[model samples]
Target chain A: MTTFQPLDIVRTSATVTTAPPAGRDVEVAKLIDVSKCIGCKACQSACLEWNDLREPVGTNLGVYDNPHDLTPNTWTLMRFTEWENPQSGNLEWLIRKDGCMHCEDPGCLKACPAPGAIVQYANCIVDFQHDACIGCGYCEKGCPFNIPRVSRIDNKAYKCSLCSDRLAIGQQPACAKACPTHAIMFGTKTEMLAQAEKNIGVLKTRGYSKAGLYNPPGVSGTHVMYVLHHADQPQLYAGLADNPSISPLVEAWKGIGKYAGMAVIGATALIGAFHYLVRGPNKVSAHDEDEAKRLAEAPK
Target chain B: MNDKAPSGAPVRVPRYSGSARINHWIMAIAFVILLLSGLSLFHPALFFLSGIFGGGAMVRWLHPWAGVVFALGFLMLFIRFLPANLPELTDFKWLAKIRYVVSGRDEFLPEVGKYNAGQKLVFWSQAALVPIMVVSGFALWTPGLDFLQSTFGIKATMDHRRLAAVVHAAAAVTTIVIWIVHVYAAIWVRGTLSAMIRGSVTGGWGWRHHRRWLKREVADGHVKSG
Candidate 1:
């Protein structure tokens, strides 16, 4: 449990004014080399043990993945996709680790309405504060990658924090530390990028022509990246978003729409007040009372 | 059966029934609750308003329930008032001379029915916007969405939830503006609040603002002359 200082936070949800930290922290990243992975479940177990989470035992649905989908307790998952290489006519099993990407611009942070519910650290780690969460699930809608999962029991959202706790204590993430194949590498972003480049070079020499890095620029590049053999089609790795970005609808709702709507509401109230003061009340006149009396008397 | 006042006193004409007044008030109160709770979650500046509702979580829990109550109350008002709120040729004329209507120049305006054109506009616009609020609101509701998915095998996708959020917020803003207009109109027109509060208005009030409606009440013996 590392104590976080105000200077550690780069951004906070629903905050109007946030001063930039005095100095920048060295940005860190987790690089997953897909070609070197062996579909082992050590990372998942390590995450559970390190986080002290106990996910309920679930029945197998005839798949290699356990607990079918990401849940509140299960922050990390191994998604298996069996694809056939058309050129080589070989069936290949692509296993990808699925969790929060911790983007430079996190949609979850943008859409959160509760003040201080979500925060982005200087190291590019996005984390949620359960105490301030209102359980509205707006973060779920804002996420382009559909990472955050709102727990039914607590009504608070849960997702991977990229092991910010461990990182603060100068240790790698639990999943990265537990990877037996050294597939998940953790270090400064520059070192990881260089390492990914070296791995991609080795992969190309082994005849994976389309191998490349999966740090999508749509969300200004994620701290968590992947080196995919078929980077051109990330969907091959179990429905990974090809071009992930915050939805335009979310942007509109949280961006211009919010400010404009508030302005219009304020203007309407002010206009009503001004009109009342200027025009005064529409009172009934004496002549109208006389007419009403005469009409009542003359009526059959 | 008429409890008449002394001679030379003013007459009173019935406008809304007791039940109708009660229904209207319930709807009004529910709308107010929704507005405060909704505003608390809408912007950071208004977040302090949540303190009245206990906190942010409380407001979140109360908002949708208040929405349901509002929808039910509005539904009754819609059915009861629909006959009187139907658009007429004079409604267009009244709208055309809206400037005069606002300036307290009733002579330039046509004789109106139980509801004026502005009131009718509030009625119909709410009738259209409330359903949008309810449907989109359900999509954004966490428990509601879960129940829908688990019970009916209807899963609301993230895209659906996103669209619902935008649509709900837009409709809420429009409704809030319209509500402001409605409340201000009541305050601007003297003797109008009494009609909803006591279920009757003075004959002079009807004659000044709604002569046609007054004449019908007199002919039908709904007015008690003193």
Candidate 2:
């Protein structure tokens, strides 16, 4: 069992005050080499077992991928995409493990309305605290990747924790440890980037001219990076967002909108109060009552 | 309260009936409930408000039903007051001299009716924004009802959901501001609260603020004086 430690929380949800900057630590990262993945579901099974998640038996939806999509139970999934290169006249099976990207500027943390529901550690792990969750699903709207899932049974938000528990005990994440081909590697971000560059060099020698890393800068580069053979066309590999970032709408709603709304409401009430103080209540004068009485007493 | 100003009693004309007052109060109470519940979910600073509704889950569950009650009550009010609130020629003149009305110098303003230009503005704003809150609210709510997704033509895509969410929050903020103005005006104008509570205003109140309406009522022989 992983013991609880005073985590160096770098970000917290729905908090106005900035978090104390005491927990500065070396950032960690997870690199997934898509080219080496063989469509094996070992990582998915490992994630389920380690997380103790019992995803209900689901039906075949005319696809090899089971459970259809990520759910409250299924935190990690293997997405398979088959594409044929028109020039080579050959099919390419692109298998990618899809889960939380653990964005440096997480949109879910920005959008969550409940304080402390979602937090990002100094080590680049974004975790959800269900006790603080309101289950309003604002995080879904805030997330550009749509990673969080709200459970109707528990009425709390759920998502991948990046196995923060294991990391605390100095153990590799279950998915990365279970990767048969060493496709998933976990280490400090600097080390992972160096490894990713070497993997790209190997792919370049194998005639993959467009091979590169999929660490989109839109969300300030994700902690979970992908080394892809066809990184030039990430969308070809299961709709991997070519340029993913927080949506402008989410930013406006969470950013200026929050402050502006409070200002407008406060200003309007203040103006009303001022008006009342300046000009007293509009009262009915005694002269007006006499006039009404005179008019009512007069009959035709 | 029982009968319309019996003979030899202080002159009091009926404004709202018993049912009308009940409806208005129901709408008022529901509006307050929805505002607190919705704001609690809007920002973390106000999340403690969820305790009033039992908890976060209860707030999430009860918000929509409260919206339903508010919508139904507002719809009835819309139908009941629409005829009185329609824009007329005097309303334009009244709006033009809004300065005098705000400054409590109503002698320079146009003679008003059952509803003034300011009151009409509140009614019309609620008319426009309540439906917005209702429609966008349904879109944001992701309960077990998948059929509702098709009803609004929302494809259940993230983009559609995001747009609906933004619109809903904006409309809610706007509506709350208007509500504050409405409540403030009612409090500022003495005798206005009685119209909604006891269902009548003093004849002096009618004569001073709404002389045209009072004249019409007297001409129609609907007045009695002690």
Candidate 3:
């Protein structure tokens, strides 16, 4: 595991660290070519082994997806979707690796309230610091992709890190290294985009005309890009969001709402102080005391 | 009716029962705790306040529990004070003369019951806001969510939690503002704090601020003995 330097962090949650690192790190990306994938769980196993995570065997729920949905222990899973091509009238089993997209403008980092709990490195790897996590699960709410899962045992959120530790030591992510067919590629984002373009060209000649790249610009494009055979209908692969962006509610809560709330609270306190300073305390007059004495003696 | 001072001084009229005072203080203490913990998480500037509760993790752990305590205490307070805080015809008159009330010109205001319009507003607003804060707070609570999922098979989705977070924060901000107003009102009205503290106010205080209440109490023979 590589220990990141403070300067490597481009953004830190709930902090005002805006100074960019003196030396810029090369932006990296993980490109998963859905067309080349064979629905093998080799990358999943490699991820589990590399991250030292042991997810309990779950009962098969009439699907090939093992362990069902993503858990805190299972950072990566291969989601298999069976699509019947209407025009071709043939069954197509579409397999996509499901994990954090690691967006350029990560929503998790935006919604995290604890200082330094979520950080985005200059290389665009969004990482979580478990010790700083408050178990609020705000990140899960902020995520457009719904990738983060908080652990029930320790109450800390866990998700795909994009293998920042491996990247730091000049090694690709474990999943990429374990890909038997080179379906999962890792390199600079520039290289991955070019590779995706070449793959799209090859796919077009092979009659998959809808093949394109899935680097959603809604989140300023993701560090994890995908070369989808039907990028126009990405959701057909398993409910993948078509135009994912941070929820406006999350944006409001973390953005203008925060500043405006503080302002309103401050104004309330200030108004109270101003009122006290101007009007002073309302004291009972001596005649009121006389009336009270007279009333108590005569009343009833 | 009044309690005579030990040195034969002015008499005091009872305003609150001992139990009522205890309940109010419990709610008040819980509100303060919730305020501090909630603020620490609300913004980065106030994050240092988390140290008071040991750290961010502890603050997260303690805030919701404090909220539960506060809600329970507030429920008791609400029941005890509801009758007193109920809107009266004179309350509208008092609200109409709110300018005079704020300017400390009480002579221009109508005689009020145990709670004036401002006090009633505080009471009712909190009554409305506390439940919202509590319900939304539970939605954002991870342990509570996990428990619901594991035990009851009730899953709160990400959108539900997100909406809850926004609602909780909005309600909390309103509650805190109302709390400040409530506290300021208590301080601004001289001798008012005694009602909650010593469970009574000077006979003059009762006659001056809540004259209608004082007259009814004396007429009903509910005065405390010296």
Candidate 4:
């Protein structure tokens, strides 16, 4: 995958200090309405075909989800969750298309050590430059969603680029384009948010009183929004974290913890050098040699 | 090798065996490689070190594997030296006069054994931290251990892996600092490096630094005339 330098990146991994020049690039988003989705795997197939990825076909383990969970080759997946609504006495099939959330505050970008390995564009799409990835899997550690995958074959990190290639040419993501029920909506962030609100209102009239958009604020809001019927209970949808934030451990590790480590290493070396200079090498003196000889030659 | 003994010179006691010296060097070399590669992946400023390992991809591939080798070598070293490096009551006396040791004023210090308090501390610290490196390294190697999810029912979640990465990096930084002290101490105590390099130390060097050890070696009739 080659970048055309088309992205006007606002933030980059491991180079957080330098801010990119301010630009007027409108943010884009993909909204998936969980209430409308029928558990069709068309989006997953479209993702595979468009990305040109050959994720190995595998047998199912008691579920409709094939190839089960996400992998390096599988960028987008249709996650199926069978939820039983206790109050309504109905079995609701909650199908969510799981992929990179493309957060405004991308934890993957924050945790990545390799420069240019992960980048966030002005349009709010988080992308991984595989060529620059060391495959150390820091991005995996950084991601709250656990999105990035490290491949053993190339030893490079990978994740959903939000179809950055297609978007560069004014085309929507393959998954959104292939949606049969128009469950997945793609447009400018503003337009998508408006559309999601309108859809949620219609869902409210249809008895989904709690229907709302899920643009999690913990990540400062993701470009990928979810219009959920049971929005208050996101965990009902296959352990989709109700309050996903970058792990505090990751924040410390990538934040002050990084500098503290550097300081400790630096201080140790400097102290060693200073000690060597101030207090010279301790050499064995002639008295010590004489003492050793006397001891060795002593009568037993 | 630098300090060749003259004819009828002072007897030299065996400090390390040839095989032990080889093991030490292997561990040392592997440690350096791991430090460079790990640090390269640690921060952007040192990422250039990835060049030494061929590239970022290669470093990523090699670091944890190299860690395995280092860990194995360290395990051998730990076992071999454990009896000697075990803390004794006299080690406290040695620790009490740490100032004298650092300032090269050993007259105030206690008669030392095969290893000093400092060496024992290094041994124990590494013993404690090496396991952390291995366990955390395994957790971070996501693609390599995806099988665990199915086989052992270990869900390698992002938060779990994230915690592991932090612990791994933190432990590595600590190990590197400890190693710096170990290397510096070996050099500052003039004849020490040669023990790992040549597998022996001059009787005089041993008597001055580790008098009790030299006495024991001589009493055991293992001393060789230089």
On the 0 to 100 scale, the lDDT of residue B8 in model 3 is 38
What TM-score against the true fold does each predicted structure earn? 0.96, 0.95, 0.96, 0.94
Docking class of 1: medium
Task: Give the clashing residue pairs of candidate 2, or none.
Answer: none
Enumerate the candidates' DockQ scores in order: 0.52, 0.48, 0.52, 0.55
lDDT per residue, candidate 2, A87-196, as tens digits? 78889898889999999989999988888888888887888988888788888888878789989788787888889999988998899999999999999999999999
Model 1 per-residue lDDT tens digits across residues A174-287:
999999999999998999999999999999999999999999999999999999999899999999999999999999999888898999999999998989899998887666
In model 4, the clashing pairs are: none
Model 4 over residues A1-300: C-alpha lDDT tens digits? 454354487887876366675684799999999888988888889998998898886986998777788889898888888888999999988888889999999999989888888888878899898778877778887888878888778777777888999998889999999999999989999999999989999999999999888999999999999999999999888778898999999989988888899999999999999998998888887667767777776665
lDDT of each: 0.90, 0.85, 0.88, 0.85
- Model 1 chain A poorest 10 in a row by lDDT: A290-299
TM-score of chain A of 4: 0.94
* Model 1 C-alpha lDDT per residue in residues B1-226, reported as the tens digit of each score: 1243324656888899999999998988889899999988888778888899998899989999999999999999999999999999999999999999979999889999888898999999999999999989989998778777888888988999999999999999999999999998888998899999988888888889999999988998888776
Candidate 1 stretches greater than 4 Å from native:
B1-9, B150-153
Q: What lDDT does candidate 1 reach at residue A54?
A: 90
User: Model 4, range B156-183, lDDT digits (tens) per residue?
Assistant: 6666777888899899899999999999
| Top candidate by lDDT | 1
